[model samples]
Target: MERKHFLKSLLVGAMSAPALLAACGKDDETVAPSTDSTSSGSCTVAPTETEGPFPTKVPASYVRSNIVDGKTGHPMTVKITIKNANNSCAVLSGALVDIWHCDAEGNYSEYGGTGMQATNYQSVHFLRGRQITDANGLVTFTSIFPGWYSGRATHIHVHIYSASGTSLKVTQIAFPEGTGSAVAAVNGYAKGMNGYTYNASDNVFSDGVTQELATVTGSTSAGFELAITLNVAV
Candidate 1:
């Protein structure tokens, strides 16, 4: 879904820090922090300062597609909406967000390779890129459904950018669907069946994230809409 930063490029956009922070995507969308759960604000800003890789570059031809071989999305395309964390959160308009993920068969090209290494693609940036949020601090991309590996559920990696193209926060977002956790009940992974959704037991989305980042939704014809929330600890 995205890539890593080279030297952390941050080209501060023209929006004022506070005004820019006000327009981050968090406002209208779900998954806001507890204090702002019902509060609707753009939720766009990211961290402002960093030490290492900051605003990275978007990889070549990082547009949406099936896979490296041009595989089309199964039921529909994977639409990712990257918005500024929250206005005043620090005007991350020009911040770079890098993404990368696996194919429909749990295989990552540049990083993990295949087979035994299937679960560790973090070392590489396959479907990676650097997308700058608009005035609203939002960037959307169309991509294919990611497949699951042996030990991990389907997921996408995201790295947020701060002011001046500094790498502020680096985290990953994943989808969970399967029986037992409504994934199976909704997607019908129960009764000895497999589906795009995993369970509440998915490993990738497992650290203190109880329905935090991704909100799973299913469509009979559109496959799934794995809505995500990227909240930097800043």
Candidate 2:
């Protein structure tokens, strides 16, 4: 979704735009190997971006290694390795990573006063959580295929914090169009296929998404796996 939609979804009591266009998790079932890596010659830091407007400041109860929180859709396994850009992109362990995204219908949990979908969902917290990176600087989240809103492709929001709880980086991750197209064919995500914008036209990813796109694998039947190396300055 565009920045404006994010603001409207989180700021107002209701939104006039398409309900599915409104802006908006983790589990520890398994530790998937990192399918994405940075070569020795090219280990630049992931591009920093906004944290999106929908992030809640409420205390999160779902801070364990698993963050699925019972929400349902095509399963997605997200594994990200946090690295210190100042240290030649070496893995930086124990940093805190917070990730959140909309559900299959594009409505964000813990925040729904905007009348995008559920009204009583304002206090509900699903598909939003945090996890501390392991010794390998890896954190995994089990989530669902994210739904798309107007002006944006399928993506996820990430915020990395230092071990001292200081914010280090804010960025978004995108999925390849092919991945999105395939997921859209599924039951819940079909709505996202319409009016969906590609990466080149998305305001946040227009510059380029090579560094922000996750290396996604698997399928809608068995679920998908997304892995990426998030290099940040410590």
Measured by TM-score, the strongest candidate is 2
| Candidate 2: regions farther than 4 A off | 1-40, 59-61, 115-120, 179-188
Q: Residue 171 in model 2: shift from native, Å?
A: 0.5
User: Using lDDT as the measure, which candidate wins?
Assistant: 2
Residues 1-234, model 2: lDDT tens digits: 112334534455464545334333111111122222456345566776655556756534568555567877888889988988667666889899988888777777776665344444676777777888989999999888887666567788898889898887777888766535444445347583666777777767777776788887777888888888877767
Candidate 1: 10-residue stretch with minimal lDDT:
19-28
Candidate 2 — worst ten consecutive residues by lDDT sum? 25-34
RMSD of 1: 12.3
Query: Which regions in candidate 1 have their CA more than 4 angstroms from the true location?
Result: 1-69, 75-91, 112-115, 118-126, 176-203, 218-220
Per-residue lDDT tens digits for candidate 1, residues 65-97, read 333345434443334444433432332355555
Pairs clashing within candidate 2: 26-66, 26-67, 26-68, 27-66, 27-67, 27-142
